[model samples]
Target: MSFAPFSDAPGTLDAAATAARLPWSALAEEIAALLWDSTVSVPARSVLPLAQGGSLFVMPATDRSVAMTKLITFTPGNAGTGRPSIQGDVVVFDIATGERRLVLDGPTVTARRTAAVSLLAARHLAPVPQGPLLIVGAGVQGRAHAEAFVVGLGVQEVWIASRSAASAEALAAHVHALGAQARVVADADAALPHCPLVATCTPAQAVVLSATPRSDAFIAAVGAFTPTMVELAPALCQHVALHGTIVVDTGDAGHEAGDLLQAGLDVATMPMLRNVVCGPWTHGTRAGKGPVLFKSCGWAGWDLAAARLAMRRAAAEPPMPAAAVRVPA
Candidate 1:
């Protein structure tokens, strides 16, 4: 049988390459646009247990132009092991041609896109968008959140707190390198009153942030994604539910938002990102309301948005030599 050469193969991107294409400002904008786009469809993600308490996740989303699937493994115990806790790849395909288009580094997409979601929430929820910030749990998400706030919100100062002093210091150094003042706080609760903006990005097996924030503070709780994990205390969640406004990233949060679910809150009735951004909902900041809590449970649509943005940025770059690409028969 004669073999015909396929001209195009999927382009691959490593961690740095993927991150380069997803700038904080641009990624946030893309996600915001997707929030209002009814054409995008995201199915429920499937999770299966792996050895040693790890989990394998399969998430898929599609739009008219492209389709994406993210396959990743999450190992919470990878901490201090020099191995990433979350590892995977996001595969993008052209819907019209049914051909692979891009393979993006999964960890980079998760960190950047997840942080961008928080940034979008802050834009609408934060009382004082520009200023000092507090990040609990100085890990990959913590670092991403710090950078996103610095670039997207023009935040000048950051306070980092973690159980591991070394990790907190390392994240602080990273934030310092980003031209923002960074401090490794000994106690997150003590630092809470000083910073109006807070992002909790821990593992969420236990409560990391329990203190009551300022009346106008904005808190993005993104650490825990499943029903079994939780980051905020039940009391804190209840307090926010009663006195403040709680916004969920998507409708899926009703089942996956561990903080709100564990707190015994009805997540289904909460305002979603679309409602806050596109609808006439002004309970959080306007009219001098209480604190705003943004609960993020993650949605595959966010990954598709990142893939779309990455593809657009890649189109602007110089193409690689055709010979460098390996096309299978």
Candidate 2:
């Protein structure tokens, strides 16, 4: 598929412009196709330490159609300097010609693609999604997941919980603005027993939800990427034999998801997101029954896929007045 004029369009996009061009549903659907692809390819992300006490990450993903790379940086000191702790840009390229195509805002790509990963998993793992939902964080991922799920699924009620009461209320308002029934909850426990669906998006260094997950619950834990950072209790996966195995974006996730690594589960032993999307998950008990949850550390493939979708959709629009247009890949 050729991503015409739009893919090769000139000028770098800011966060707002990037969001305007990439629709939530399109992002979820495009990522869905990429997830089930048996041949999906993405090399392990390259991590390097920065001399200033932070880090730099080089992540790239591509296929036969197009390619993209996100050059991101992590600067811990920037947090106190009134600057973003993470910053980067996404560079898209034409697969066949090896020519650079477009440069998109990295944070926007990261936020949308990351949220879409968990939502895509929920789409398949929680096939019977309905009723109230719980979101564990109130930051960017929190907002993105709320929007993606509320827009991509049939979520009726969304409950936001965060360490900061103000943060939770802010996200609740955003969800309500999306035309969904939403409110700020006291904490995760407030909705655990009854809320059938949940997505944890916090930055906590330790476990967040301590209650035993319901047999029918579908939790998407999107926070805690490093080994030292954990967001879910180990019993969740340990009980998969009787309840469910954690659903992950890729086998690679097990290496990054503290929840899985700390649980003593091998990435090779778990059912990946691909398995859930393409066929009956092999990890579930006898008949693929019981509780199901998705854990996402992160993935570059999602960025490549969502960027392509944005380009394809943006190209279909009537020619813009000022943006330069280039030919297809």
> Could you estimate the TM-score for every candidate?
0.93, 0.87
Model 2 TM-score? Answer: 0.87
Residue 3 Cα positional deviation in candidate 2, in Å, after optimal superposition: 23
Q: Report lDDT per candidate.
A: 0.89, 0.76
What lDDT does candidate 1 reach at residue 221?
A: 92
lDDT of 2 by residue, 199-242 (tens): 89876466788787777778888786777678888776566535
Model 2, poorest ten-residue lDDT window? 319-328
Looking at model 1, the pairs that clash are none
Once fitted onto the true fold, the runs of candidate 2 whose alpha carbons sit more than 4 angstroms away are: 1-9, 36-40, 51-53, 75-85, 280-288, 319-329
Per-prediction backbone clash count: 0, 1
